[model samples]
Target chain A: MKTALRPSVALLLIAGILGLVALAFAWAGGWLSPRRIGGAAIADALQDNLGKPEPGWRRAHAKGLCVSGYFDANGTGTALSRAALFPAGRIPVTGRFSLGGGDPLAGDGRNVFHSMALLFRLPDGEQWRMAMDHTPIFPVATPADFVSLQIAGIPDPATHKPDPAKLQAYLAGHPETKAFMDYMKSAPLPSSFANGTYYSINAFRFVDAGGASRAVRWQFEPEAPFAALDKKTLDAQPRDFLFVDALKRLSAGPMRWHMIVVLANPGDRTDNATIPWGAGHRRVDVGTLTLDRAATEAAGDCRDYNFDPLVLPRGVTASDDPLLPARSAAYSASFRRRAIEGPRPDALTQAGEGGAK
Target chain B: MNGPDTLFAFPARLLHWTMAVLILAMLFIGAGMVSTVSAAYPALLAWHRPLGIAILVLALVRLAVRLTHRPPPLPADLPPIQAAAARVSHYLLYALMIAMPLIGWAMQSAGGYPVILWKGVALFPILPHDIVAYGWLRRLHGLLGYAFFLLILGHVGAALVHGLIRRDGVFRSMAGRGG
Candidate 1:
């Protein structure tokens, strides 16, 4: 094809050159190695889907209330995990309860996520952070898919709403999304933050004294009874009703949850966050978590925290769930962005006016 | 034109140009990172972390090369003060190149943040976690970053003075052509 080269030889040379260029790009982009999906990309993807990111607010679950308390371990967990908190003592804890959405000003309403994120302060300066949603599992399987879902959810500028056709195409390819949707629609709406079971959907390795590691997932099973949420009552409540309700409930008495760990039976997938382990798996009640006080996020102990799901203790190790690292990176990116953005504007406005706490 | 005696070792020239390009990119990326809350921060940070470590490694090698094989002398007519300034500035550049990455590693360690170069490869924490220490180190890193930029400006000025104005071989020695 060329002036001096045969057709096949020329094609091979072109292909070789193209391949080398691709290799060079891969090396630079970290594709040649186990380069992660960039946290900034995923974080931006989420903010894009969520609309304009609020200054000094989380990119997701922006509206939240912080709580302080302790975890009373009954020693039942020591059989599975050698975490210092599992040694039957009251360990200091800080946590937050939030409604999922990017808008901190969004009202408490239906079809939104309710979540509890915790930081358990163990002995000798070790801390374990856990963020769990009311739902039993993550909506997607991997970090890349999560990013793709966020991109798919980006609003059409002309309509100011996500393109339904794009979402439908995404759902057709990802049955996991359909499964998550089905579960959401069929599952009883949480009546209150205290009433919902907060699940650590991703599997983790619980290492015991003998150095044996067991695949496990856990939930904070609430002491409060569950009841299907009444829609009319929910609609009538104020914008910050969830936070108000949580404070009200706490004022009367300390709220509690039992830390329950579910061990994987043989052949259960520890890597995939979307798959649910069979019901026959053994579960152990590990500890009791008690919340005694509530504080506004503006001045709360949890204010600057980034409740990354991958922050595990010495006894706890991350599983093959790729989303774990993705969560950590994205949360750090979000945290860094807000930290640079400075104090929340509402906090500043309130301070300027000498408003009541 | 650079005489054979004036030119640096071949390896030295290669490392110089390689590091010059990398360090300049690092400065711009660092500036972009703090100036915005955009989603692009993560990608910038990804490149920054690995690139910073690479600069550190290259700086160490370059220093070794310099120590073992002394650079060419300044021109015979050069002022003593100018020569001293060159010596001092070059040392400062090397120190900053080394210190910036070390401080970044320490800051991440103290803050209990991961120094993830890329997926699957994470740099080890060299310091214990202390939030207060992390805050102080972060401030120091920011301050040093500015100082490094200024030092680079002075360097480029010195190089240009020798190359274009004085027509000395100083710049040509490391320019990677007919030295």
Candidate 2:
């Protein structure tokens, strides 16, 4: 009995040891698993940190703008005046902006939101894409949400007019859009193009030469303070008031805007576009962007350019934002579709032509 | 007979062959479902959940049988390292078989998605909604899938080496004789 018990006890001990080892291995594997953040986190971090400016922030801001390929050298030694940020560089970019469909020709003086796509071809040839919106936060977070809003806002085919009822219902369904809508409704339209501020809606990783990475958001603030447009002034202005204002500023002396880089806490999700980042995460200015030259229509200055976010520097990488991936897919599909259909000659030519009733 | 003169007993052999056929069928069905796009594709997906549960249940039974029954000893001429490797590989295959289905089920549950094993038959209750947990599980599922693929490749490669290069009866033992 003693001998039989010893063999059985030894077998049980071996099995127990093996089982414990397996459990330990599984536990360690699980603990070492990688964690990924979505696009919403990126957007939040960028928006939360973009209010104040810093010294290194200007170069970083300029880097982002340069990456967007929006700024060019004016040949007068000033780099910002030129319309093309990168003259002969190829960097994929995608841009989306919201404009009132009710009169492509009517200058209602209502505030328009523009999301700029800037893809920069770095010296190392890596592409970095930036999604810059006129407002700090986008109205909607996801493509699905955006599509729903768009569907609700679309005009009836038969009537060729927007259905107010549908629009109201849509807005009611999505109460989360209230903050964005409030900002849009309350923020005064810039009377002059130079007064407008552009924002990076998504958080981006800024890797320094030392390999230290801090999440950042960027803002382009006009040197001149904002002058709000009144109803009388808006009505008096031509339909192309915004475009003309931009062209006039360019035609004048070099246009300069301070580029502000805002630093953010890596883990914070407050400013994630859907939710507003509180005062604690205030933006600090980093640098200045001086536009020294304006491009003529003959030079294809206003031609459609795409900006993609997957373009990053050797050190800089993207956060796994759900919206970022969805946006990337949607932008790629839209850009490919648009490019195949050729440029919108009418919209491009309209700004320079200058016709008034 | 005490048992077959193999690493596996009769019950283990039956379980192994049954699972092998079912899992092979599942892999083929999964590949086909992914490639084919039709109205019936959702219907095919509907079949996956039930089949996966069935496989999971059978794998549990196999594990239980393996724990109770002592498998036949390796060939006396087999090197200690090679025999150890064979045992480890078999254990890994079993571990993966047990894990993959559970991970897939957890992913669906975490995503707030239904995991209907059969028409109106729910094998497990839905997990509470948690985005972070869902993301982690999704990434985990993807990582494990690659590992499973690699292990399968290694297993197949080792089997071929034994059958052809080493000219060992390891493959034939599993393949059965008189074929």
Candidate 3:
């Protein structure tokens, strides 16, 4: 009886040990955590990326400023409608330029990158937020990996130096970043905004007046493409040179960017921001945005702004791109955190309160 | 084992291990669901929400059982401070297990997203669209998640210390053996 029981006890112990080991692995993978896998950090990074100063705008509202255009019921373009998205007939737009380093204040002016967002209100009294980065494709899909990249790019809090080994390891592991790297290497980091194309890295849905819906990605191509800045030119000028150029444009006249919408196939997942979209899906001209007014930094019109693709108009919806949903969650969480900590008011709440209108 | 009740029961132990396995499986699958960059993956998201709800329900049942069932006493050799710490930690673990899933459900509900526990079974009726509540609940969810991580790390550390450093039967009691 003792011998028989020994085998049974050993078997039970083995099974229990196996089960516990499996469970530990699962929990560590983010199963037991409240935040979804890759959800928390993605949200945090997006908030961090968007919550900075543009030369002209200060964060006035949290969700973002809104921009509205008047269109007849038939959807034919009419004159610019009442700026329902912004209170003063202008939505506060914030722009941020940086090298693609994780640190908020990393001043490697060599590979200049720019991200701009327009927070405006629509005619229907809803808040609209749009954000884009210099590089089109995000480096990694996982929030953990994104956090790792941020840590690698950022200076060590104690030492104030970036870890070269970690950065090299990260770059080596993600070869897909090569396409974006190639683009950055070839493209000029300009004092003027005329050299590079700023892409809406994530895909969005646009509904035409006819009720036809299409997945759209936006790219702002300069009228005349300029060669990328060499290492010598970058070292000569201060990092804020791009801001001065943009300010000059605003001072000169209405600065305009042709908003070209790249049409995506409904069935195509190739060009989703998480993965590369093939060149087969060509972009079509949608409309133009003319920045007629200068942005003021003292007015607090452009602080803590974030871009979520989910914040679209009635005609516009979001695609099933994994990054879009992840971004929506991330942006919402970050905005929420900032709002609670004070200084920045919740955009959605304020928009409802008629702050933007 | 001349001490106050501390060691968990056979049923409690079994439930703990089983729940552990299930929760871990859910996490692994959750990670895979996000990491796998394919169009077919959204179909998998349909599974994650429901599975999370199921885990939440199981956790609640486990908590109820733990509260009702009197566990075996800890080894008399365990100091009062260590025993108190163990009790507090266990309660925290239970709290985290229940809180994590509930917060996630509330966050999704506040976002006006569906909370389908199973394919058709709705856990809670859809929440009225409230952006303020959504924001508050989402932040709470994220904070609680970090808290949960800290608690888990502490629990693991204590267990390792007991098994490796203390060289006591404290680990074996939970390890399910009569020495």
Local distance difference test values of all predictions, in order: 0.78, 0.51, 0.53
Q: What tens-digit string does per-residue lDDT give for candidate 3 at A53-82?
A: 322122212222222122112112212122
Clashes of each: 0, 45, 26
Best by TM-score: 1
Name the weakest run of 10 consecutive residues (lDDT summed) in model 2 chain A: A59-68
DockQ of 1: 0.08
Residue-level lDDT of model 1, residues B46-65, one tens digit each, is 68899999999999999999
Residues B47-163, candidate 2, lDDT per residue (tens digit)?
667777778899999999989987666667888998898899999989877887787788666543435564324445345634335556656655665576557656665665554
Off-target runs (Cα >4 Å) in candidate 1 are A1-36, A345-357, B1-90, B97-179
Q: Candidate 1: what's its TM-score on chain B?
A: 0.95
In model 1, residue pairs whose N, Cα or C atoms come closer than 3 Å (at least 3 residues apart or on different chains), thus clashing, are none
At residue A102, candidate 2 shows an lDDT of: 22
Instruction: Name the docking class for model 2.
Output: incorrect
* Residue A347 of model 2, lDDT score: 35
TM-score of 3: 0.50
